[model samples]
Target: MQHLSVARPARAILLGSAGLLLSGCSLFQSSAPQAPLPASATLPDATISYTLTGQGSMPVVFQSDLGDGKDAWDSVLPLAEQQYRVLAYDRPGYGASRKTATPRDPCTIAAQQHAMLAQAGVKPPYVLVGHGMGGLYQYVYARLYPQEVAGLVLLDPTHPDHWRRMQSDAPTSAMAIKARRKLMFTSIETVEFDAQAQCLQHIDLKTPLRMPTMLLVRDKFGIEELGSVETLVRSQEKDWQRMTGAPAIERITGAGHYIQKDNPVIVNEAIKMVVKKK
Candidate 1:
């Protein structure tokens, strides 16, 4: 039972009064281009807070890490919207979204997210962009509703069998990871992250992904804390491609767990690739 979270950094998007002004710009948050977004683009839901841009036939959905919200993608959204409609949201207890007593399992979270977008009138056959645990959530969403997802871009997503692999491959590193997740993670995180790691085991890692998919991993995956696991992690990550039907698992050099914020150009290009898929 290991739900290894990707631990994403931020989401990028610029708000313009006209809903969107799509254009390519450099991949950066501070230096990323900006546009004035209208107030209506933001929709505060009864359970979550989400921002939806444009009404294009196709939709690009952005799901953030467990600790972050839609604002995390603010820097990248501007560029993405230049070509497609996009949606970003705050899962319960992350941003303005309130926490609930509901059990925070992958299935429950996926269903809730689906309901949120459905209520917003956002159609599916979507290109999903997810980071960290958000990556896990989006993956589950695609599994539950295969017809709804057109493609997937997972940014260092939690490999469903993270803990098992760690324990089997490196026991000491697994303990350290457990302690780090419990201690270093902020208190406001609504999801019981450590506990959920076990639940991820329920998912079948070999389940074939019907849609085009890519797994983007950070170059120095475990250097920051557990350097020893680097070798083991690289080996384990290979399964993500096999499971998702991705051509290859790509690595983002000079990037951390939050590949979107560290090297957004690659992330954007991946999204573009999915969008362009027939």
Candidate 2:
């Protein structure tokens, strides 16, 4: 396994409140537009939107983190598309996609993804790349249709055990819980969050991930800005260790939760490696 080296900057912590606001702003901000692709995949539920680019026998499918759209992967797509077909889609209620009445559980969301890909005529044997919460969806998809997945590259993914083990006393955890409660009655994100919470509750972490897998862990915990959610960080690390048969397990320094944005080369390289394995 090849490890990519990145330069770490001097440690300086942002105030917790300011960090949250800045992160939220960065996540929702529109990225500069890329040249439009000629074709887009529109599912029967016309609300789901997706774009497919590049060309190869085994396609690279990207799933973005929560509160983010397909555009989040734009910087990484150029090189990925150069060698293989890349498909990035906005999940329901994000980007060009509109809200759906369907339950947002992992199984339901995975099913929708399957239907969308099928409708769009994109065949399986996909190299799956997922970030943050998107990783859970990919894992569920692989479990539901094991034969369809060629490999997986999970970028600082959320562990199924996160919510359960998270220290409620921690400032970050408290903020998260508070936000979850507020969103529950006010926004669609709450519905999705609930679905993820439910899925995590029953997820069988012991199940083997048979496909070639690569897990990238961020080296910096950003404790200065986010308070010490030590338990949460440790839980994620434990989850990474559970991928016993994985081909690559890397600790990426100089990056945070949004590893792809901080270092697209690492993500793109991982995708390329997985594609070669297939």
Candidate 3:
């Protein structure tokens, strides 16, 4: 998914004059904002923008990749709505949500999600469907509130160990560190990226997820575009499979990073697997 470029100016004003670096497809264009949900919820620093559709016993909550908002899941919402209650929301600074200078750490982000869901009256035993960077937040949420999350579907998620593995090259390591510091002040996504990396270092992998989990890996990553780093990313995907202990692992062919957009059927299949678990 691409980034939201036009929102940069407005975000700069809210965050600081340092320039709020924004990325991802336009939140509106990606999902084509439908009629507003019947209600909204106010969090500590920002009022989240979300849509709740369908009605069922267990809710399917969707979280988008970095630089994306809830709408990124637009393609799969209709299918999911046929059988489940669906919840998709914009994070603090994405889409219609208010901007904040929050620390953007995984724990803080996960906590806010818990509070937002509670305040919105969205009940628990949730089946979390997270894409890209959003997977990190979902992982933390499950860890912090294990009783609430029933299952998980990770769609081409960023492996927690990606940074540790990718930094083997000295040049890449230095460049990444420098870029992260620069983006920290200008981009909310960047801040979260750094925080997730830090959080991963302390994670106790010995504690098994032990829930119904599915890990989806894209079969084709444009190696030409990524250069030599493509090899490292592919290696990390294998590592993620082993680390996550996901019972089902699917390799989606003919799809790029945004597998949901490229192939909704596969994504939906993954979601259904978890949702059907007893």
Q: Compare the candidates by lDDT and give the number of the best one.
A: 2
Compared with the true structure, what per-residue lDDT tens digits does model 2 show for residues 16-135?
Answer: 111111121112122433454644456655467888877678788898766667887866777677767788998888888888778888878788888888877889888888877787
Ranking by TM-score: 2, 3, 1
Worst 10 residues of 1 by lDDT: 14-23
TM-score of each: 0.79, 0.83, 0.79
lDDT of 1 at 99: 67
Better of 1 and 3 by TM-score: 3
Q: What is the lDDT of residue 260 in candidate 3?
A: 71
| Residue 8 lDDT, candidate 3, scale 0-100 | 17
Per-residue lDDT of candidate 1, residues 1-278 (tens digit): 11223333433221100000112223454334435332222223337767777445778899877667787686678777766788888777777777666667777778788888787778888898888777778898898888899999987776666656666776776665566556665554524464445445666667779888878876643333345466655765687778888877787655566676666667778887877773
Which window of 10 residues has the lowest lDDT sum in candidate 3?
9-18
Best by TM-score: 2
Off by over 4 Å in 2: 8-34, 38-46, 167-172, 180-186, 200-203, 224-228
- lDDT-wise, the better of 1 and 2 is 2
Alpha-carbon RMSD to native, per candidate: 8.6, 4.7, 7.8
Supply candidate 2's per-residue lDDT for 195. Answer: 65
